[model samples]
Target: MLESLTMVRHGESAGNAALAEAITAGAEESGPGLRDSDIPLSDLGRAQAGAVGKWLARQWDSVDAVLCSPYVRALETAEIALRAGRAPAVRVDERLRDREQGLLGGLTELGVQRRYPAEAAARELMGRFYYRPPGGEAWTDVALRLRTLLPELEGHVLVFAHDLVIVMVRYILDDLDESTILKIESNQLANASISRWERDHSGLRLLKYNDVGHLQ
Candidate 1:
């Protein structure tokens, strides 16, 4: 059985940079209009991934299995942090992919308000957990898929995924509700952060949350 699982969010990506810039500028939209799955890592992201890889290389004796989202940023992070597949072979899991942003994929709140007003208003009213964009997914959708994925894996599993993926996984393990989970997401963690949890006789117990000491 899987004793423990360590989840790592992909390093900062070009999308991340653009989003940050958009927020800084309070723009109408964000990101480079590229497919969300195609965005690559930024230079800082590469350095962060290298640092995480070295840290993990020293800390973990072995990883029994590795899973990753197929998104380019997540793939790059897994390659770097695992030393280019020198560790456990990475298995791409569609369930581990980032939450589908849909019409909101590359837009900020302002952008959504300007270009997708009804969608934006609906999101605010429906809440983040169940707000499914026209062609995207809800947070609950991501959680349901991961819940299915967990039952089939075992041993020490390492995963390279995304921010929403990380938070949803935590919410699943902790058995949190919409209110509490919303609170959890508000205090966002950094890129490339790691979190660990162990399963025992009782249940899942968190070993770490948003750990990034190696980047220091």
Candidate 2:
């Protein structure tokens, strides 16, 4: 079986913009719109999506299918990229959604940390790959879902998800443990950047990781 899999994270959202502004102003305040799902993309995010779509349109004959998280930012990113070509069938899979934040959802980084000191400490100590938000999922759980779904994919496929999802899925596909996975930068896969991998006799091989030059 010939399979080419490409993964991408959703574009920057209003949450991102808010955070950026806060950072620019040197304020540690948290915003109220950083939900775990369906955060709309910002203007820069749209630009990134368009650029990624154009790049992908040139890189492959066509995407066989697009599997996306139901989050608005992810859906928008996938739609923008697919529309650049003949447009592939888009499928919504909850398994691909962002890490659930529970009460931390819709809060800024400071807000989450301040609200859930123990959970925040846990996340910081364990790293994002293994960190589990209170009343939320752990990386192992996300890995299980991805493992169950990945083998079912056929042909060329594109997945649009969140940073943690990408890292966890990559960990499973690459057969790496927490150590190696933890070494990877969380933003290694930029907002519209794409990472490619394919299966071989040995197993899945990493052809590339986090290619965002197209956005430049």
Runs in model 2 deviating more than 4 A are 23-35, 60-62, 122-128, 186-188
Q: Candidate 2 at 187: error in angstroms?
A: 5.1
Displacement of residue 34 (Cα, Å) in model 1 is 1.5
lDDT of 1: 0.88
* Regions of model 1 farther than 4 Å from truth: 84-86
Query: Measured by TM-score, how close is model 1 to the native structure?
Result: 0.95
lDDT of each: 0.88, 0.78
**Model 1 worst lDDT window (10 residues):** 54-63
Write model 2 residue lDDT over 1-216, tens digit each, in one string.
437788888887777777777767755564435454747888888888898888887855646877999999999888887785774788999989877766565556766667678878888888776777777777787888888888888887888988878887788877888878878854455777778888778766888788788888
The collision pairs in model 1 are 2-155, 28-111
1-115, model 1: which lDDT tens digit per residue? 8788989999999999999999999897888778999999999999999988987886465578989999999999988998744567889999998888876778887888889
> Which 10 residues in a row give candidate 2 its minimum summed lDDT?
27-36
